[model samples]
Target: MIQQVFSIVVPLFVIAAVGYFYGSRVRPEMRITNQLIMDVFMPALIFHVMIQEDFYPSQYLPIMLAGVLLMLGSGVIAFGLARLIHLPWRGFVPPAMFSNWANLGLPLYVFSLGDAALGAGVMLVVAGNILCFTIGTYIYSGKLSSLEVLKTPVIVAVILGGAFNFLDIRLPLAFDKSVEMLGQIAIPLMLFSLGVRLTRASWKDSRAGVIMAMFCPMVGVALALLLIELIPMSAMHQNILILFGALPPAVVNFILAEQYQTEPDAVASMVLIGNFFAVISLPVVLFFVLSN
Candidate 1:
């Protein structure tokens, strides 16, 4: 079990470490790289995965529903915690509610659980992104950004890919390979960018960061436990749900915070600390899931 966990976890951190070391030394500008990933690579990956012969978007709907519940439940709890401690809800709740399902969770799932897990992973991203754009955006920007959500490349990929999947349309062989190749760049790039992003983390809000670093996974796992008791799902799906809960705060939370002029610093702190802490939290979660 330990070997299995190590095999899965080490590769991720090693790549991230490479990115970290390089980022620390050179401090390369990442805006264009991040933009390319978002605008091109990630969408290709999603579309490729979505169009697979075995891919059935509807089969993952239950997991997506669980994801929605997890986000909402986390937000509710975060709201209470923020009010109790007098932290701004705008900063705290978004980080607490949304999670790093993309950069960390996607590759982690595929590594630990194998290729079959990709569908569930994609659906989970869909659920997280939808709420992040709609409810999470409203929390910070004071307006429902529904249209903005539609404009996102990832979401557009999901829509197109899902439509193609449902219609049983296959891309021409050469074009399919092209899309797959493009898609392949997203996961590693995501991890590397994550490492680069972490370089910018300020410890100024370390207390809040520590608080959430601990809270996010625990809350998610707790919600997953509750969800499984109420919802019937396959064992793998159950495990997926549990891991979904254990994800750290998404880096996108900080981006959104920055865009909305919210407490970007605090959000950055929470994101960075929460992800670093995931080195421990994820292993424990993986052991629990793999053992079961």
Candidate 2:
């Protein structure tokens, strides 16, 4: 059990650590890299995975619905908590609602649940990304953000990939390989970028960060438990949703905060600390899910 847990986690940390140390010494600029990821690599990955020969959107509808409930439930809970604690809702709620489905989640699910689970993981990510880009962005910047969501590359990819899957359209073999290769770059790059982004977090905001680091997973898991009882699903999906609920905040939360000039520092703190804390949270989650 311990070995399995370590195998899933160690590689992610080691790769992120490489980014952390490199960023510390070189202070490399990441704007262009992040742009490329959002505009090119991540979209490619989403399309490649969704357009796979065996992929079926209908098969994962239960998981997809559960994922939506988990995100919306977390946001509601986080909203009440934010008001109770007087934390800026703008800074706190987004990270609390959107888990690190890409950076920590994709590989984590693959390693822990095996490659067969990748499609489920991808479905969960697509659900969260849709919410994050639409509702999450709206929360940060009001109504105008609606149009922006339409233009987001991730959302665009989801629409196109899902369309291709539904229509039974297949890319030519060589073109398919190219997209797969490009898609392959998204996950590792996401983890490394997470490390680089952590370097800029303000420890002074660690109090709120710590609060969220603990709060996010608890709310998510609670919601997941409730939803699973309400929604019948396969054991594999039940476990996948449970782990998804336990994931840390998405690193993109901080990116969006920065983009909107919200309390970017506070968001960064939550993202950095929440992920650092996941080293503890995830293993416990694994023990629970795997034991059952």
Candidate 3:
């Protein structure tokens, strides 16, 4: 078990560590790279997975529902916590609600659980992206639009991909291979960009950040445990849900915070500190998950 844990965890952190070293030393401009990731690489990855001949959307519906419920459950708890602590709902709730699924989740699941689990993991990410763009955007910007959600590249990829899967239409091998190659770039770039983002993070709101850093995952895992008791799912889905619950706040949380001017400092602290805490938290979750 220890060896399995190390095998899964070590490579991820080593790549991230290299990114951190490069980011701190080189401080390369990441805006274009980040845009390309969101607009192209990630969508290609999602589309590639969704359009695979073996891909069956219905098989993973439970996991997708679990992901939605997890986010909503976390949001409810975060709302209560925000009111209790006198923190702005916009500042605390979104980060608490959205986990770092895209960056940490895809690679972690693919590495630890193997290729069979990748579709389920991608489904979880798609579910999160839907909510993050619509409901989560509403929380930050005070408006929601179906058109706005549809305009997102990842959302478009998911919709089209699901359609192709549902209709059992496989793309030609040459085209499919091309898309797969583009998709493959996303995971490593995601980990590397994560490290770059971390280098720019500040520790201004350490106290509140620390509290939220712990609070976010606690609420998620607790809700996941309760949901697993009530919901009958496959072992793979259960493991994915638990790991999803254990994930830290999304780095996009800080991006949105900065964009909307909604306590970016506190959000940044929560994002950075929460991720740092994941170094300890993820292994514990993995131990329990793998034991099962």
Candidate 4:
């Protein structure tokens, strides 16, 4: 577990450090650069990651379903934690609902378990994205920020990708090759955007935010581990799901908070702190999980 943790963490930290320094150094139109990344680079990466890989899930459906249910279940657990703690309704649910499944969870899964587990993670990510953009947005709208049902990139990406997947259709090889080339830009750019966004925000030691950050992912990681045990799964597959839950807070949480005006600062703090703290927490959770 120590080796596995270091194997993943070391490379990620180095790349993130590079992004931080590079973003600080570059003075070129930041917004334009971000837009280029979001509109072109990241999407290509997502699409490429999904399509280029062979999406075979002979026994993965159950795990995928478990991942979805785990997230929804975590939302309930998170809300209970909040109510018990008695934080304001406005900020509490968003942070809890906005999981770190996509940005942090997916890539790490792909890296750790190869493409098959990543496909499972992708399904979970899509379901989470739907919930985040739709129901979660409903809660945040008129309270924190405006909610537009159709304007989310995650949703758009899923719809297009899913349609093709469901129908078992493939794009032309030439076009697919072109897109694959473009998709290579996704990883570095996604990491770079994260660094740039983090740079723009300032972190404060908000007690409530820190507390929620500690509570939320812990519930998630615990549930995922329990599911791995109770549900019949191979050792390798269980490791994949366990790691997904152990991931840091999703950057989308911060974006939703910023969009809806819920607890952007708090969300930022959760992400900034949650990620840094994951160096310790993830290993702790994964140790019991993997050993079991």
Q: Give the candidate number with the greatest TM-score.
A: 1
> How many clashes (backbone N, Cα, C below 3 Å) per candidate?
0, 0, 0, 4
Regions of model 4 farther than 4 Å from truth: 24-38, 49-53, 56-60, 142-153, 229-235, 286-292
| lDDT of all predictions | 0.91, 0.87, 0.87, 0.66
lDDT of 2: 0.87
**Model 1 RMSD, rounded to 1 decimal:** 1.0
lDDT, candidate 3, 126-206, per-residue tens: 889889988888888777876787898998899899899888898899999999999999999999999888888769998
Instruction: Tell me the TM-score of each prediction against the true structure.
Output: 0.98, 0.95, 0.97, 0.82
- How would the candidate models be sorted by lDDT, starting from the highest? 1, 3, 2, 4
Number of the candidate with higher lDDT, 2 or 4 = 2
Tens digits of lDDT, candidate 1, 72-103 = 99999999999999899889999988898988
Residues forming the 10-long window of minimal summed lDDT in candidate 1: 56-65
Could you tell me how far off, in angstroms, the CA of residue 233 lies in candidate 2 after the best superposition? 1.8
Instruction: Give a tens-digit lDDT track for model 4, residues 127-193.
Output: 6666777767776665323354346565566567756766777889998888777766666566656
